[model samples]
Target: MELNPWAVAGLVLVALVTYYLGHHSSRSATSTHDFLVARRTVRSRRNAAAISGEYLSAASFLGVAGIVLKDGADATWYPIGFTAGYLALMLFVAAPLRRSGAYTLPDFVEMRLGSLGLRRFATAFAVFIGILYMVPQLQGAGLTLGEIVPGAPAWAGAVVVTVLVGANVMFGGMRAITLVQAFQYWLKLFAIAVPTFVLCMVFFAGGGPAGMRSLGAPAPPVFPKDTTVSVKTNVTVKVNTETYFYAYGEIDDGPARGAAHWSPAVPHKVASGTTLKFAAGTPVPVVSDIPATNDTWLHPASGKITDLLQTYSLIFALFLGTMGLPHVLVRFYTNPDGRSARRTTVHVLLLLGLFYLFPTMLGALARMYVPQLLVTGDTDAAVLMLPSALLPGLPGQLLGAIVAAGAFAAFLSSSSGLLMSVAGVVFTDLLPGRIRDFRVATVLVALCPLALTFLVRTEDLSLSIGITFALAASTFSPLLLLGIWWRKLSWPGAMAGMIAGGGSVLAALIYDTVCGYTGTVPPWWTVQPALISVPAAFLVTYVVSRLTRSGRPELVNDIMLRLHAPDPLGLVQDRVVARFGQVDDKARTGRGRHRKA
Candidate 1:
């Protein structure tokens, strides 16, 4: 395990700075409003940065590169769809939701439809979605740190992030989080950009290879040096050429001396903890995916029914899912008015779009430079590992450290937002306890996902995060879009749609998660449920609202006016302030002077 002490130190240092900044900013938060929405005083640009910071999770920082590296150009749309989700938010959700002046999604639901039942249902989904989103952050952390230090337990990184994020949230609340998150966003951008710049420079300085851009199928990836590759899990490898295997730490495991098998009907298992040594000229065996040659590394799709369905399903989930995310919506509430909300979203789109460009570059370069990862299924670590592979020595390690810091920043910033959203829902809507309840909620929210990390494998993590998006899109996207635009949506319709849309997707996700563990593969439809589930949620919601006579005309009229009216009109109910003073009422006080004193 070649763990760089500097890289580990860099990760811890960012966590400390984040905690201190959050704590310092939180000192002035004396009320629940301050804690939850920063008193609705966030400016456009800062809030946009914070939103982007949280939105670019480990998936954006690390997973995108790995997916592109493994799957080629067809996987490029993940980042595009991710950035475009903001467009959906700006058009349908941002201004009106901000104008409504609610602190959380459930608050908006209750305010819009006048139903406590629906509020609880929405709150439940918020908690579920927050945790569902958070588990991957933990998984990525473990995978990242594990990649840095090969034998490190996956839980180590998760534990470190949770501790830092929990402290940040427990101390600062939203006011603190806004500053901390915005800072992390720039830090992450620097971390990714600087390394990308340096690596590209190095690639060109080494004299850009003519064969690096080969389009037709070429030879399999060759080891740049005599290397020993470690297998982290039990996987089957397709050996197209002869290779050497060292079994049980000895050079005598094959039939001649090491076991070598031809293409057999039954695939052989390379058990966990096995190590394979290859000479410099050896061809790396392909695993689990179609053979990719140098000539066609940039192919559009894998020509699989599942890949096409998964791509469209992913695009739908990410595009529609952004507006419905609980944490993302809370950032809009922190904006002072509707115009600010729209402006913030526009900035977010620009920032995210700019940051996404380099990951594709990293992925493509990684394919030529570090194809061994494709064999190990640790392509997610390609972003972190690529720098060291290209630069070598201290220069490479330093660049690698920068990437690690950005990766940790991704976990910290995103985890803090998720914790805040979950705790806010727990305190205000679900538990309804005092400020102390936030402390309790923070621990519970962090613990659930940390425990879940043990159950989920690091392989195909983008798919896992996509499944959660499917849940958010299916269940809440319909409710949010309809409640804002459609006047006649009743509380009953909202509840029914949430149940049908969210329920079906949730069931499919559970089946996939569980079945995946038992070596069972669920159908493509079950894995990517957005196309069917999202439409079903919308359909059920519209039909139920039409049949149910639950909405009152006056309440609907009031909510609609507030949502659509300009901020100068002051129609939004956000101005209600709580104040207390000596009443000095003689009848009630009996002694006015004593009451005042």
Candidate 2:
């Protein structure tokens, strides 16, 4: 793809203005409220927009489309889980988390758990989750930039985005991020929606059903060749002895790649009627199991159990993890009161719905128009590839530019939010004894992830996301839910759950990394950790609370009343004067001395 100077120029202009707004907004902010929660003054609509913008990362824009393009209807789980997750947030997590009035999840932990040790553990967990989440955003930015600037390096793109994000977070904190993410959400929707509409027209005019068949005709029964494609699939433990795996990858040049192998049979108990085939003279390899359709679009493993695992894993992560997201949680504090927070969650759902519709459409378009991407082995690039391939001349260039800008925004918005959350935790909870330089705290947090991005790079945005989700589900989700709803929740149980749950997940992650276990890595590695760890946390808090019962039920009632009540926090008082009670006024006139009798 060729670079258009004008398009590049447009992107640069957006970047500059975004940075200016973020930097300028912070110059006046001096207090903790200004730095952490935008002084809790944002309205519902803006807060909602900012929340949606922050949550919709490169995965929503690019990874989901890419997954759908490569895997068909099964991939729809991405959007469904994402939207449904917010519903979960609105119902179970939103108001309670906001009402806690803690700056970060760790702060909430410290307050609820009442132990410096527990706070430190939660802080570390947060930093880990935040960094794990940051990597993919940086990678997504690099991928988008590489598409636009022909010769630009991935790290260069990463650097540009990191700097922009850091500057915004450093200067304005939550206030600046609110504006950026809110603006970015609309921009992202436009970038995807306009191109998607144009592509749909092209699809209909180009041949619709007929053109699809014609373009698809040359596609081999299994185009290219077939080999034992090494696909990373999720498996579960029904028992210890028997492990399950599914997913077949591309085989470039072999009998399996070219010839048929039915005798050996498909492993993992493929669907009863599933058929596998290979076409001749096809230049690339294709692997699919959708017997009737024979379209490469639906090649993923098929089974009731496997399907359930994937669905549940996605749902759990999406729903539970949203509450734990530092970025999302902090937004609640941006509102003036609980009502604004509740309203913000509602508006966020609407904005998220609007934006989600576009990416799903684009993913479908990519499957039809840009099947060639499967050959390049980068499905994640589908969002970028489809635009340039279909549109010629200026429209293509313009859309490409828009996408590039939007991608940068996604990275910047998400990164800034995560960095801000981490910074709050580090400064307040991690170093509670002393006040650190505010500037130093912000930079320290930002720099760590920026460094981590360079050290670990991946094309798999989904995998990166899963790592973060697993971490969040294990630690903060358990901590927050128990802390809020369960009055019996003891600080000991909170500490135990966070450590046990968080530690188990961390150990699994390490094993996955060191052992190179390249399966979907199993939902057990994900959901099991949360399911068990969360309970353990609750139990520990219970037992520990029983042992050291303060019996201060009134404290619990008081906190609840404050959180749920409709007062303006009642932390300030107004001065009043009455003219009728003014004997001092007569004394001031000097005739008052005579009136003292």
Candidate 3:
């Protein structure tokens, strides 16, 4: 792919604008309270925009379309699950969590259960989930930059995003990025919505509704024109029909590999760095996991029993996981009151629903326009490549630039929020809760995930995010749901349930990684464990709480009332102030003594 000056300029423009907005807004963030929760002064609509902006990460921006391109009708569940999760959040968590007067998840854990040990344990999970969530945002950045400027090292974009996001968080914290994120939300919407409208017009003008009907055609997707595909990673592809193509590089590990005609009975392995050129009308050879024909792709639940199981697990993770995301939950703390938090969630649901419509449309369009992506398994690039593929010449490049900018904005906004949440947990739980410690924690949190981006290879962006959601669903979902509603919940039960849930997911992840290295396919449950893990977590929490009923906190009733009562009641005080009052006092005293000297 050739470099597009328009796309590069759009990326640079978005980055500069993000920095300026963050810098301008950060002026008021002089205290720890402002840094952590924006002084809890954000109103409903603006906070809703910021929350929506932060929630629509690279996975939503790029991976949803990519998955749609790969899986056809099956991909619809992702957006449904993602958007509906907010509905669940609004119903169960939004108001109650805001009324809890906790700045972070750990703060809530400690405040409700009155257990320092459980608080520390919850902190560990927060950091872990935050890091897991941040990884794909950085990887998506790399992918976007690479598409804009061909041949650029993937880490370059990751590093650029880390520096910008780290600077924003370290300097201004949540207050600074809140405005930036809100602004980016609209920009992203404009960027994606415009291109989608143009492409849909173009599609209809060329083929009309008859073209739409062809999506369910029995034949496999074919190249619209002569296309060249470069394999960045080794992949095994299944060719459903007899196809002849010109090959330059290793194919199937053959001794003499160049310019070969292929007949397909079994899967064929194409090594990385190989380039294949195919003529127009050639049926695309798709990665083994993808459906080889449009009919199969369009049909939902077309796979075996495992695919059905995986779909349910994916749904469970996404629906329950929203309430548990550390970054997402922290946004509620920025609301002025429980009412504002509830209103913000409603606004978020609407904004998210509007934005998701475009990606689902884009994904469907990609199957018709960008079939070459199937051959290389770079379906994540489907959204980035779609505008140019449908619209030719200058128009295509400009629209491509818009899509690229939106993709980058997705990376920036999401990464900033995740970094803030992780840094807050680190500062409050690990270090002293001083303003200076926030800066240090920001650096530490950003560096750990940035470094990991180098070591770990990028998978399907949405799939990776789904795993984190599963983990969150297993661990914190049970903790929050049980902690808030059940009077009998003990620290031991919360801890035990969290361990059972988190440990199961971790064990599955390890097994999956081992299978990847050994070139074996893991079970469906390992891929999406929420179906097993979520129920296990809830059951364990209930049973263990029953067994340990005698050890329940005496303040459970007060906490419960505080969580459920209306905002005017003021049933609870800010637990963060109570928990860290001594640290704050010591810092103040030290500063005063220094001034005296």
Candidate 2 TM-score, C-alpha based = 0.79
Would you estimate the TM-scores of all the predictions?
0.91, 0.79, 0.95
lDDT of 3: 0.89
Local accuracy of candidate 2 as per-residue lDDT tens digits, 1-597? 677665577679778878876776666454454566665567888788778878888788888887776666667767776776677667766766666666677766655555667767777778778877877888887777777787687787777877888777766677667777778888878877887888778777773222233224434222222212222222111111121222233222222223333322333222222222323322232223222232434554466665566566655666676777776787776665566677778888888888888888887676555544543346787777676666767777777677767767777777778878777667665453222344567778777766777777464576568657766776777777767777776666676667776777677666666544464444444432444444555566567667765532436655555455654665211111131122123332232011110
Model 3 Cα lDDT, one tens digit per residue, 1-597? 678899999999999999998998777666787788876778888898999999999999999999999998888999999999999899888898989989899988988898899999999999999999999999999999999899999999999999999999999898889998999999999999999999999897883222222476789888888888989998999898998988888888863255676667889988988989998778889999998898889889755898899999999999999999999999999887898899999999999999999999999999888889999889999999988788778989999999999999999999999999999999999997888899999999999999999988799999999999999999999999888788899999999999999998999998998998899989998899999999999999888989997658997877899999988876746665744443234443332111100
Candidate 1's C-alpha runs over 4 A off are 207-217, 239-267, 294-297, 302-306, 551-554, 575-597
When sorted by TM-score, best at the front, the candidate numbers are 3, 1, 2
RMSD of each: 5.8, 10.5, 4.6
Q: For model 3, what is the alpha-carbon lDDT of residue 188?
A: 92
Q: Could you arrange the candidates by lDDT from highest to lowest?
A: 3, 1, 2
RMSD of 2: 10.5
Cα error, residue 585 of model 1, in Å, equals 23
lDDT of each: 0.80, 0.63, 0.89
